[model samples]
Target chain A: MGSRIEERFSETKAAGRAALVTFVTAGDPNMEDSLALIKALPEAGADLIEIGMPFTDPMADGPAIQASSLRALEAGQNMIKTLAMVKNFREGDSHTPIILMGYYNPIYIYGSQRFLDDAKAVGVDGLIIVDLPPEEDQELCVPALAMEMNFIRLATPTTNEARLEKVLTNTSGFVYYVSITGITGTAKPDPDAVSRRVALIKAKTDLPIAVGFGVKTPEQAKAIADSGADGVVVGSALISVMQGHMKRDGKAASTMVPAVTDLVRSLAGAIVN
Target chain B: MTKSDLNTFRAGPDEQGRFGIFGGRFVAETLMPLILELEQAYEAAKEDPAFEAELENLQTHYTGRPSPLYFAERLTEHFGGSKIYFKRDELNHTGSHKINNCLGQILLAMRMGKTRIIAETGAGQHGVAVATVAARFGLPCVVYMGATDIERQKPNVFRMKLLGAEIVPVTSGTGTLKDAMNEALRDWVAHVEDTFYIIGTVAGPHPYPAMVRDFQSVIGIETREQMMAAEGRLPDTLVACIGGGSNAMGLFHPFLDDKDIEIIGVEAGGKGVETGEHAASLTGGEPGVLHGNRTYLLQDEDGQIIDAHSISAGLDYPGIGPEHSWLHETGRVSYVSATDSEALAAFQLCTRLEGIIPALEPSHALSHVGKIAPTHGPDHLIVMNMCGRGDKDVFAVAAHLGTDIEG
Candidate 1:
């Protein structure tokens, strides 16, 4: 069977619009609320879901996603619990593609083959390991592909024509095009510049290009969608909203889920329109 | 390990920068071109005699190279077994061996036409070293340090500021060396064009571990010559404290081919490994990735990088150099750890017996000497790298010893 990532992009293509990819740390606030939030994402208009695997040192992330990971880890989130959340989400919504995104250390420690097997068993369609570049593809990317999992690769502003060949060699599913040179949530990408890069990347690969990092609001999502991206991803802004709704005691306030879903709805609506 | 593998140990990193599946360019794509550019620049610099001459000139006239390999008469007498020698790198101009690598990297930064320098520091020795070089070369420098480190290593913090370097205090992920490094990498990613990152240790990406080790191998090079001149032979054992394993790798890389000499790397056992509060990556951690290199890292079962604990800020890092990991796996180097109390006692012992105030980083190595020295015969010679001076560590050590000093 082909990946749900491919299936989702095909559906979005049929709808003549970009997919809305929503990101959330798997156990942010707590596991129960996190599961509830993810289950609500698809109906609220998220075409694809990216679940963050919380790590202590998220070097590529900005402050907001970093805080989200810490919150998840502080609430006792681990690979087991993260997968369990995916399993739970898959039970109700098998059509929505769920991508696990984070660093590679946890999966390296968890055993790559075992992680791929368990992740596939729990219906995790793709992975976006932030720290694993194409040079170190043998570590996990090759094994992940052998397991028929979509090993998504990231394309950035610094990825030259020669290097792009290496990056796309074993990559399947969608290509994540980082809009800015800095870490997540640091700076906004100019739509004209991002559009040029997205067009260049589309010329090189058949995989759908998803633009992320620094796209914060509905307008930003609309701009990225207009830039020829197949999907528009918003992470730090959503996490920031949830953070704002958190109580002083660190528990999620009653508005946490609604606040997050409302933002996702707005972003999705922007792209759909 | 086989003889072929042992013979090939010196030839590693192999184009893509893997120390047998350890070090690689595991950075974001935005940093890939910069890393590759750095790799090319470093390779070219390695072959250029003028680059070597300039670096040597800086080492000799500026950083005070060939730091003496002095025999510790009292400590050796007290140990009653091996004759202990101190590779007095603490006598270097910046008060640590960190300057050795900084001088080399700064020259490269200039050669590459980069106008700004960035670095990360734990105990602040590396920060001070980078800051000093930045000042000397008239380049703008920024040092990323944990807020806790800035508070604890006030002297070095003041020194960096005095050198006219900007200090960015990082308050993320337990606010230590690893966090500081993350922040620095983020800064490098943001300012890749005009900035050159002088990584403090033999960690991070590929060219860094190899390049930093190349720069630091001067320690081993000097030690080899001095030991041969003094005793007409190599030392039986070599010991060095490891945070990111730069100093240890500096002293170990040159001697890796010598099958007869034993190498030991001491890691910080903050309270003790049993207490789950230590920076002993090889001793207590599993193989994982952090910063950039895949090495022995202190991480939870689910792969979250765990905060490392140590009384010494320099050794309080959760990951080690990938070369150290490869050496450990190959059984070329034996790794051990020493507790905070043990290191404190060793610090006091070295100060009293040797009349030298040793940094807490090297005190971990000295602690191991106390244990291993008694077992070996007097004919055995042990050289331990005194990587830093204790001046910057006085306040921390004083507080640890429960002594109050009013400034």
Candidate 2:
């Protein structure tokens, strides 16, 4: 286990509650409001933060998260800005585990070794590149794990028992069980099925299992937590809150950060209780 | 990197499916298992003689294969240099070489017991091919096409609809071929249980590029045989236009090991590569990952995919197939570009001289042929793949030529 992710999961276990892992684009609308939202997430009760490094083509994301990435890129978000955002977030808060997630092109262009070294220097805890599976681990995952940054792997419903072992081999962080087989925030995942899949994953490794993809509201998060997951991830739901506060010119409204934090607070409360 | 061991350029993609540094299974975790399964199924089908026999039968009876290799005598006389021949893949059943891949993949999909079919297209030739295969197989088909392409290639759009395909107009990411492919991938992820995505070209992940190339290699195989019978010798040169490089790879792959056969691939130079408005990935782009493989991509310094522009919708993609990237890097094939106006001039010349109105995609190749054919001796043989007919492009061509025609 890595440092911040391990400590956070241990704390959540001792607290007898599932951790609320909130996700948001690093530069959605603009960099300033995005930073404000990131700074406010931990105080609103997010135990872990997954900052999306925007790419031009986000294949695995649904419409909401896809829109957020486009908005970020349009606002001049790049790998450098994203890492700087993580650095800035680390200054305000140190306990929250920051995981950068997205496709791998920008990072590949940014130079893999350089990006990983910079990310580790600036206090990034983990990574969740959706495109890099166990087959292509040599590309980035192996290097990231060596950096003491948890290389999180997403195990989807399509991942059979044989393939699950491969997914868990080099995974340092918790196992992210994509509750649905589809893209993010598209379909609703059944709590019972998610519970069964969580147990299936937990039987393989000691890594805590986190349920994501289709987790939206407080009730859904609570239900997933009750299903024995160590964490519940809410991404498109939070981005939808930010989307509601956007102006005509495609910038975030003044209420965007606060509204997103408010929803995160409610979701965190539900998961904790 | 040893030159002595590098004997055959045909043997590629190793076990991890990489050609040099390009081409790997870079997809979301949800689709990895499916890709592996498809790879397994394709390997099995390759070994099964029954599968080969069925495919061959379909190729002969269904697709009207062995498309003629005609000598462009008038154009040869006009050029007054090299003797020119055209491998008329445009004479295939769907009027394009896309049916060759669609038929092969649909057979594989059926062998895997997939109940539905999905595909992405730019000029709608591939969409029409997939829809035709799905109709023949009695499976539900969905085609994701860019809204801009649907507007321009309306005839092919109607043909896909007429074949009972659900045409989903994709509006994201500049509304072009790349966007359509993205949407198709999303749809495949959501419906991974029973859907088989028939990637239109030689660009996708591992088995896709290899599999599509194998399926379309019939063009090159037939060209070799026909050229031997017609001229009693191998052709000196092969030329084909590349969008996602399917037709070019089809005609080029079988000849890659033939060291003496010079090969050329033409990319769409929309307004010339210098203007930064072209789709010439090899000539004007750098290596990056997109659409499940690492290849030469038209991207900015920040790695954002810059939208490509070309008058022909089929040639207006930002990236080429990974194998092409390998071939380009290793100097196995010469990559060049032809501008829109040049292709337009070639389109008119081909129609008037050869009495074959070639599709705008292959017009890029013909334009290159016109450039170099006159420089070679009359004894030299030049064969170009006429990959598609111009029936689908007549409206666009007419509009480009400043002529108004009523449908």
TM-score against truth, every candidate: 0.98, 0.99
In candidate 1, the residue pairs with backbone N, CA or C atoms under 3 Å apart (3 or more residues apart, or in different chains) clash, namely: none
| Tens digits of per-residue lDDT for model 1, A1-273 | 668999999999999999999999999988998898899999889999999999999989999998899999999999999999999888998799999999988888899899999999999999999998987888889999998899999999889888888888988999999999899987998999999999888889999999999999999999999999999999999999998888876678889889999999999889988
lDDT of 2 at B150: 92
TM-score, chain B, predicted structure 1: 0.98
Where is model 2 more than 4 Å wrong at Cα? B1-5
How many Å off is the CA of A57 in candidate 2?
1.0
lDDT of 1 by residue, B1-407 (tens): 64455555688888888887788888877788899899999999999999999999989999888899999999999989999999999999999999999999999999999999999999999999999999999999999999998998999999999999999999987888999999999998888889999998999988899999999999999999999999999999999999998999999889998988999999999999999999999999998888888889998878888889999999999999999998888888899999999999999999999999999999999999999999999899999999998998888888988889864
Report the number of the highest-TM-score candidate.
2
lDDT of 2 by residue, A1-273 (tens): 448999999999999999999999999988988998999899999999999999878889899998899999999998899999999988888889999999988989999999999999999999999999999999999998877889999999999999999999999878888999798989999999999999888889999888999999999999999999999999999998898999998777889888988899899989888
What's model 2's lDDT at B253? 91
Backbone clash tally for model 1? 0
Error of 1 at B155 (Å): 0.8
Q: What is the interface RMSD of each candidate, in Å?
A: 1.0, 0.7
lDDT of 1: 0.92
